[model samples]
Each structure stands twice: as structure tokens, then as C-alpha cells.
Target: MSSSFEFTSENQDRFSQILSRYPYKRAAMLPTLHLAHQQNGYISPEVEQYVAGLLEVSLVDVREILTFYTLFFQRPMGRHHIRLCKSISCWIRKADRIEEYLVERLGVASGEITKNGNFSWEAVPDCLGACELAPMMQLDKDYHGPLTPDKVDQILEVVSDSDSKV
Candidate 1:
């Protein structure tokens, strides 16, 4: 993919609105990055440059923010980003088995995308704040928990079907 990036007109408008909320343009960095990520699935080096130019910050400044936050992606990711919590609570509930099942079923290791680019999985170090649903995963925006292989299969099937429609 090309490294060039330009914010869409709608995003430009949103960007301006976001900047208006901040006393300094630099203060708008996070939300501006969000808009870039929404427009381009991940933040590439070119996106960083584009963002720095817009905010009048150095490229290194943009890179620092992107690297410091787990929310940002430096490379392309699949349509579905699966974040499985591996916190103490999740571990006590056997999140490992869930991770293994997901790896085996998806045929992709953690931090890697599926061959077809439909999904990507990652094991998160922090609590997903769903201790009650220990052994939980955040698929895109939805939270599912206490998963079994069967439930996983069902979820994947549903996600696949929905992805196809889009």
C-alpha cells in the first residue's frame, strides 16, 4: 500500500472541531490520531508525517505518541481485532487454553493477522475490566467471556458473515 495519506473532508471538519476544543494544537494529538486511524486502518510512517504537519509538531513527536499507546497500530491489521485479556484474573480462569484454541482455530499466532486478513488476535497484559467474565475477550467493540471452543466458533462464524456483508 502507498504511504501517502490525506484526511477526508469529513475528517478534516472533525479535526478542526477537535482542535477548537484544545488550547494548543498539540493537545489535540490523540483525537487527531484517532481520526487518522479511522480513515486508514493503522498509522503508517506517512500518516505520522501527515499528522505532524497538520499539528505543526515534529515527526518524532507523532512517533512517540503512536509508540507509547497500545491503541495505535503501526502496521495494517485485519478487519477484526481480537484482544484477549491475559490479566491475573483471566489467567486464573485459564485464558491460556482460550488463547490456544483461538490460535489453532484461526491458524494465526498472537499479533498476526489471518491469511485472508479477516482477523487478528493479541493477548493483552492489562485487565479488560471484566473480571466477572474472566477469560474474556474484546472482539472489536463487543465483550464476550468464559468462552468455550464452541462459543468461539459461533462468534467467529457470526463475525465472518458480517464481514462478508460489508
Candidate 2:
């Protein structure tokens, strides 16, 4: 139910720095959205409005950029975001079965958040740029590869355990 979103003081400084790099305010859209996402976790409608106001652009303009980019998250995506590669290389490596395992193990369909609010996942149809690590997934910011159900279990276990410690 929490609603307020703004850059922290440090991020406000960073935002100022970001603005300085662009010749025009509108040119700063991507980096500004990235800053907002880093600080707020996701880009909500309020954020679109806020950014639009900041850059002196229309809300439609901000939204168009947001929707066009796959990396920008439009909703809360839990503490961990898992991107499973379903590209040709990964699919050939039995990534389909791995996706099935994730659905079964997480008790949620792809693109759904886990009930516990700790994880959300999506199957990416495009390459994750680690073809050598076929059957790979990007968990948060790290890529784990050559996955089997066992490796997936271990990865989830490690992340879950770390979450508990924090």
C-alpha cells in the first residue's frame, strides 16, 4: 500500500549528474528511467508521470519508451527477477523442460510473481548472450548456466538462504 516514490538524496545527485550529460532533457529518458527503476524497483504510472514532468515530455512519450524496451519493469517484480532463456541455443539444450521445472517448483506460471514475494520469472525468447552457457538463466544480475533441475535447485536454495539471512 506504500505509494510515495522519489529518488533518495544520493540518487537526486546522480539524477542531476545524469541530466548534465544530455544536451536536452528528453534525451535523458532512458538513463532517467533506469535511475528511477534502480531507486523505486519498478516503473509505475506515477513514475511515468513524474518522469514526464521532469523531462518536460508527454506521459504518452514516456510510456511509449517504457513499453518498447523489454528491460523496463512496469510492476513490482519481487526481490529476484529470473530471466530464463528460451532462445534457439537454450531451447535446443532442453530449456523447455527447465521452464517446466521452474513452473512446477515455483508453483507459478512464467511472468507471475511467487506467492512469497521473493521471486518473479519470465521466459525470454531472445538470446541472453551466453550461448556457451546454454540452458542458462539470469537470476537478478548474475547468469547461471548449463542448468539441470539440480543446479536450479541449488541456485534457488542459495538465493533463498541468503534472503533469510538478510
Measured against the true structure, the TM-scores of the candidates, in listed sequence, are 0.92, 0.91
Task: Give each model's whole-structure lDDT.
Answer: 0.92, 0.92
C-alpha lDDT of residue 50 in model 2: 81
lDDT (Cα, tens digit) per residue for candidate 2, span 100-129: 999999999989999999999999999999
Residue 97, model 2: lDDT of 92
lDDT string for model 1 (67-166, tens) is 8988888999988999999999999999999999999999999999999999999999999899998889999889998887888899999999987898
Segments in model 1 whose C-alpha atoms lie over 4 Å from true places: 1-3
lDDT of 1: 0.92
Runs with alpha carbons beyond 4 Å of true place in candidate 2:
1-4
Instruction: Tell me how far the alpha carbon of residue 79 in candidate 1 is from the true structure, in angstroms, after superposition.
Output: 0.8
Report the lDDT of model 1 for residue 3.
43
- TM for candidate 1 is 0.92
